[model samples]
Target: MDAVEIKGPAAAFGPRHEDINEDANRFGDRYSIRFVGKDKVCTNLKYKDKHSSVSKDVSKEWCDGCPERDGCAYFEPFNQIKNKTRSLTAPHNYLEIFPDILDQWGDIEVVLIDETPWYNIFEKTARIGAHDISHTRSALRKLDDEDKADSDVIKRALSLLDTLSAGLSDKDGGERQADRAYELATSIDFDELTTELTKIHDGRVLEGTDYTDAIVAIADNLTEIKQTARWASDQGIIGEFDSPPEQLWGVDNSTKDNAKFELRWRNVDLMEIARQKPVFVLATEMPTESVEAMFDLPVVTVEDTVTPEAEIIQLNSRMAGITRLRKRNQTFDNLVEFTRSLFGSRLLVR
Candidate 1:
């Protein structure tokens, strides 16, 4: 033989103990097989040409040309077998031998071939239709909800106006003052004020207009009631006063100084009304503890952990794949198709 070749399981079999004795019994110490018809046998066997096989070896050419190429137990099946397998895989049919291609060539470049430009044009038209439908539906729903809420709010405001009008029916006050009070109370902006005030009161006991002249009136009435009740209690006319009589008027002098003390307390009440303005309770009630705790939580840093070598390699590989895909010549249709593959039908609409 021009070249000594091992076949079947003998290719993997190394020198055995019996081989040493056989070699010793042979004519020469280094024994070799010489087949005279080997050249003729190789010529008779079907083999791939040098250009097709890309190999100088006859065995490699023969293997490449063999009719039972896929039936070989050691290697992957032929392209026909792979194509059949891909047909059964569904959706991602082209990925069957992709890994093998990548292993051989380091990476496989996927070229998106768009033969029909009309598909892209149709897809864009469909996407615009979908977007318009989605937007119109969303807007309609939002407007409907807003209209319902606005109607309810208007009804409640109108009801409040009727109540205010009834409350002032007997009051002998200037119409201008009442008008100003009504304007301030009934204003839509006052809703925010009442909402804030209710938060402070821990409930919705006060209406938007209640904080205006109504609150001042209630406070004045409460002070007068408390004072009268206290006086009656002092002369043994009613229940005993919880606090001292002098504290009510801030008077600590004798009965001779009572009139002066009364005037001073009256002035104090007026001053309290002028200086102590009410604020929204809700705005002031925000939890400081939870906010402070949020600030006190631990922070993450880049130095806490390092990327693994394997992960870095995988990232690099993916980046290379992306770069290769980007460099490939692709039509607009290809991009649309790829995007559709990634996010499904929503990709085009979005």
Candidate 2:
């Protein structure tokens, strides 16, 4: 881990994991937080991609208008994170921030998962409706009229919208039609469009005006579709979109005029991406069988010897799944009373 000194809000933990401190990363007597630099602290993808070498302005741009800025105590006027920090304090959703973690970190030596990483890895689905595209086109026109957004960028985006409208036309098989749309989606100059739209969004957010909403909506939709295409292509199952066949993509034709397109990827080999590093998951409750099923890997359980003072109870009853417990109020009330009688005011029903 690159060890660098960081100051101000740029060094603070993100909102969800702010409770964490240097103590949480203590390995024996050594603290790992000292290695976590600015790139890891900032969730901005643009900054993380370049590591510490990325411009400080990237972090400033995000923090300047961040909704979470007001709640953080370490807020600083400038970002102090440096590139290639040796250690990182990442959240449960670090995969979202560092999708290419293995590439950047080069085969993780060890990972102490605070909880189960049993969630879906790379599988995702994104959709947008025809009307949403229509609204985006109109919004872009409005922005152009007001000189609030770049006319060239707006024009290109509007043209892409037209391409999507044409691509979505029902003229062939579902797979062929979807492929046509996906091709159009992937052909976008994503970096250029995203950067321009993000600038507009940052400015618009400050003004409390959602003039960029429709444009943002379409951009988000296309980004998702592009991601789905990449993952599907990587797995060599791009054309197999049918659920029974491969579950990669789908078209929602329920609405005649406002049809939606959904794209999905079933699974990704988490270990393959991690370079087969040993993953030690810590959890209060985790199903080994579930983990094995999703990851296709063997799991060994290690139970703590220290026992809790609280009495443990397990109920094997279908009554909890009953459709309407209200109809059997007496039965439910009796169970509650029995528990309350045993525990007094300490009983908590959740």
Candidate 3:
């Protein structure tokens, strides 16, 4: 670990143990497993892959502005919109930032995650329908003019509507929790919505608006109401959507998700690997924030505890910049060999 400092193969905890499975990685003694979190298991034996099984619940609202609104899946229309947009993420962007790292490493590459994407069996599915936040806003403004809203509950709800309206105006997703707050405001109590609407002679909220019915229909189902709030908050989704479906069924054939659950998730019984074990640990090199200065913990300077045959790596103020580390193709064996060459023969197992 000392060589990780002064010389720099800059190491960090990489993927969680759950990231690997029989299909994604090799098993047996060469690998070490570290189990975490809950131990739930599931299987897919009789679930057939059939488009027929997916009966589109006739949610017409999602189709309103979609170019292929006639009959389209959420992902289908989304793919078209997505192609028109681009982002500077990961490998490509980083390569541009540090072009010389490519030259220096000579095609040596350090890997991040495996290529296969895994899906959770219990995936959340948003209902597709037409939604108009502006209409909802109108309904809210109507409530602001009501005489019955003098109560504390009604007052707080109106205040929340104001906050939500301000938040919806902000297009920046990183602006605290404003977007989610706006979504929640859209799904608030029906009485507020009713007040905002132009009521008929019989005191009904306006009926022509696509989302008006759902507001009144789901007023009492608290669980569905919360789910509706979640669906609204998902920025990728638009339209008046209902609560998430009871279940979303999809089969993942990749080795990553369809692997033997027991083998993929097992406890780490040992903290120290045996010297004779032929195993290598993979870690990421992340350039984290540097402390301009620090005091020794407990106000006591701790002396080095390893043998002199071990040479320690030093990380300090001088090596705090982004250039201090770069993703490169490196092996633990190379680190062990380099350490031995410089500080005599000491094993790299810890």
Candidate 4:
């Protein structure tokens, strides 16, 4: 005997192109009851497809004796099948199934299914999709509220972003390097600096000192050196550290001289110099090795009772020490002269 493969009734089949419009409209109305004011409705009801005829024929037979025929315009079998599928797939919609009760609540949550035949019933019932802009707007509003509630967190986030923006604005190597150095100097923890500096110097461990204090102390001295360099540069005494002439002092002499000069100066030269000068030389109590490493130059500790002239002499001795290190090394003549002028006769010791 041949095996008979009996297919179920055609009514059990999925919705065809002909049933799309009426189905979409019915779904839109149902969806609007729960989401109308809070969300929008959309459907792929293009004229390129014909779904009306098939929907009407199916609606006549399925809804023939149904009491709820007036309220529903969907094909009866399709509607029944879709309703059952939507109920299973979207419990949230099912939870608020009774439209009268949901309407009274004023704020109902509706979740629409995918674009498949099963989900189409839900769409016909509650027209929503994953890409709805209304849903996106609602989610963003919730996030904005949370961020607004935390002012300190927001400020920190903004500060970090500002720092990043400033860094990205400059593409020049010198500017980027200088910015990085500045960031490192300002943001480094003093305690960490102390620990690292201590390890480098093999010095007696200092007590009661933290990273900030150490970093601040070193940063103060660097600020002075930087200021001195700027003052010398402004006086046409020092050239850029990495440029030709390798001068410790002298104004920039590029083709666009004044323009280059202005670009190099502006507010930074004065502000940084002023801010950094006072702390140029750390206190006398600092370990000699650590001080030397911090400045990348020799350091001399003098008693508080030392005179200004004696301090100058001490600086001269330090410069002499640096000169010894530069013996036989190529010296940019202009830079050497500039440095000598800025630091006075002491810078020429060698």
Candidate 1 lDDT at 180 equals 40
- Candidate 3 wrongly placed segments (more than 4 Å): 1-131, 143-154, 169-171, 178-207, 212-350
Clashing pairs in model 1, backbone N/Cα/C closer than 3 A: 200-281
For candidate 3, write residues 192-287 as lDDT tens digits: 444334242112211222333222222323344344334333422324444332222111122432211000110111111111121122121211
Clashing residue pairs in candidate 2 (N, C-alpha, C atoms within 3 angstroms): 1-86, 1-87, 2-85, 2-86, 9-74, 52-82, 52-83
- What tens-digit string does per-residue lDDT give for candidate 4 at 1-350? 11112221110011234223334343332322222110012122221122221223332443465455454433332344434322112212222233332233323222121222211111211111112212222332343465532444333323432333343333342344334434444453334333333332221112211111122233334444455445445444446533212121112234331211111211122112112211123123334443333333443343345456532223356456656545634444434765455321111010
TM-score rank order: 2, 3, 4, 1
> Where in model 2 is the C-alpha error above 4 Å?
1-91, 98-109, 112-119, 123-135, 143-180, 186-195, 209-277, 281-350
lDDT per residue (tens digit) for residues 114-189 in model 1: 1212111111100111222233233323434555325444344434334334323424322333334334333443
Give TM per candidate: 0.12, 0.37, 0.22, 0.16
| Backbone collision tally, model 1 | 1
- Candidate 2 lDDT, 244-324, residue by residue in tens: 221444456656665565544334444443233444455424445544443456555555554685333344676645434
- For candidate 4, the per-residue lDDT at 66 reads 48
lDDT of 1 at 166: 35
True lDDT of residue 191, candidate 3? 66
TM-score of 4: 0.16
Question: Which pairs clash (backbone N, Cα, C closer than 3 Å) in model 3?
Answer: 2-313, 6-313, 6-314, 61-130, 109-329, 129-240, 130-240, 131-239, 131-240, 139-196
Query: Top model by lDDT, which number?
Result: 2
